[model samples]
Target: MTFSLVGHCAETGQLGIAICSSSIAVGARCPWLQPGVGAVSTQNITLPALGPQVLEHMACGLSPTQALDSALTRNGYSQFRQLAAIDYRGRTAHFSGSETLGCHHTLPGELCVGAGNLLAGASVIEALVRTFETSGGQLADRLLAGMQAAVAAGGEAGPVHSAALVVVGELTWPIIDLRVDWADEDPVGKLAQLWAAYRPQMQDYIVRALDPTQAPSYGVPGDE
Candidate 1:
């Protein structure tokens, strides 16, 4: 059983996703991002290979929906797939196949959207969709809030296991990519807290990458 939300922030101007599941190590099955390209999440009877292939199609100028359609068409077992994609420009596309596990649904929104599978109930998806659209903030903040709403609405029926969040910019290698492969409990909360903690570090890293050799002037005695 699992409930996941994979989406990109339009104004954050980055591609990213937040995911969780009752399944052991769900991170291993979903979430993929490449800077300057696109983002993909292949799950729910997943055809994992499609994730990368979708990016290739998008790179060739195909829109999000067109890329998804072509990728699914090429898959031998398209009916069993639950996948979503978002391009660099914020266009979104998703497919929830007929053979999806149970109570599976995906909502496509303007700035963001989400897909859920093996859900505890229909409420999970509903809450996520509402949160994504109603939440006010930049893209990343909205995505995070939507995910927390889904978890609060009762996440996957199975025990909390693994969780992950990935974000990338036009040139940023990885602004945020944190994973809790297997947590005893509250993987989503842990992921949120982890993200909060890592944000500053990542920002610092970005700063360093952009212009290193500048040190913070804290407690420095008068230099000669």
Candidate 2:
């Protein structure tokens, strides 16, 4: 009951993932990324470890396809899992197990990969890749736009309760990691709103982490 996209921004060398699902807290278990490495999404049967496992392989100089293949080979339950990856080089790869839910498919695009299970149709995946390619601005915005287009095209077979957007640059942690872990309605829209509010402060937060003295004031009580 999940739809996801893994993308790489060639201009900025950023990696990101956007995902939504009928299931709760899809973010907590699906997206995985390492700065300068890659982005990975592991869903369907959902072996959360596969995200990091695949990334480890990518960090070791394997391509997205080779990394995913190496990781899946170690799991006896691969037949039920769905996974996708995009390396720093923008090469993409994906696997859809034979048992994926309802109408499921994986579509690879330039510097991106879209995958879904229990979706309305293959058009969902198509819209995801197409929108990402055509969208503009930051990597995070493109990812969110791709997700919004996928939903408009026909999202999951049922309502989506949770959504997430994650992006990583040249840091050890994600620059954008916003999630609507559980919402009664329009979780993707809620996630987009969160990103809107966070975008202006994203750089400030990084500055705070890297150099407190150079960081701006919090604009709260004591800081003011």
Candidate 3:
């Protein structure tokens, strides 16, 4: 019921994940990332705890494959989960459990891993990897492009009701975290709109958090 991609921007040291699913609030459950660690997506039977556990392993200096392998070994229901991870160095790994629903696939790219369960076909994962590889822009833009390509390639087995994009840079908090938890129409498109509106002010908000006197005003009520 979900399709997701986890990636790293070697040029900027950024880690991010983008996901969409037929289920509601996929964002809250499927994606996880730490600024200097790694990114993970846990879908299918969706053991949400596995996401942070994988990140913790990567943070402890384990390679993405090693972290994923260790995490799966501890899970008795590993066969029912679909997982993907990318370490801080852009090393990637992915697993699609034998019990995953519908036509599922996983593709590991140069600095990313794409995974899906209950998907349209292998082409969806392929499109995600191709878009992320060829698309030129910020890490957030590339991640969004990958999600767009996934939808263009037919997306999940059913209409995706929720979508999310999360990117982490130097900040402890996510630099970009946007979601359409549930939408009758296209949640990915809705999330894209939110990104467009937030991108320009992203640094400004960070500045406000770090030093309000140096922060730029966007003519908001308190600016005067």
Q: Largest TM-score belongs to which candidate?
A: 2
Instruction: Report every candidate's CA lDDT.
Output: 0.77, 0.95, 0.91
By lDDT, rank the candidates, best first.
Answer: 2, 3, 1
Task: Give stretches of model 1 more than 4 Å off.
Answer: 215-224
For all candidates, what are the clash counts?
Answer: 0, 0, 0
Q: Which residue pairs overlap in candidate 1's backbone? A: none
* TM-score-better candidate, 1 vs 2: 2
Query: How much is the lDDT of residue 81 in candidate 3?
Result: 89
Give the per-residue lDDT digits (tens) of candidate 2, residues 52-121: 9999999999999999899999976888999989999999999998988889999999999999999999
lDDT of 3 at 163: 93
How far out, in Å, is residue 135 in model 3?
A: 0.5
Name the runs in model 2 displaced over 4 angstroms.
none
| Tens digits of per-residue lDDT for model 3, 1-224 | 89998999999999999999989999999999998899999999999999999998999989988998999998778889899999888889898878999999999997999999888888999999999999999998998899999899999878889999999998899988899999998999999999999998998999999998897876878665
Candidate 3 Cα outliers beyond 4 Å, as residue runs: none
Q: How far out, in Å, is residue 187 in model 2?
A: 0.5
Better of 2 and 3 by TM-score: 2
Q: Write the per-residue lDDT of candidate 1 for residues 1-224, one digit (tens) a residue.
A: 55556566655567877788776667677887777678888888766688888999999999989998998898778888888788888788888878888777788777565888877778887788789788876555667788889888877666778888888886647777788888889888888889778865666677767776663433458932
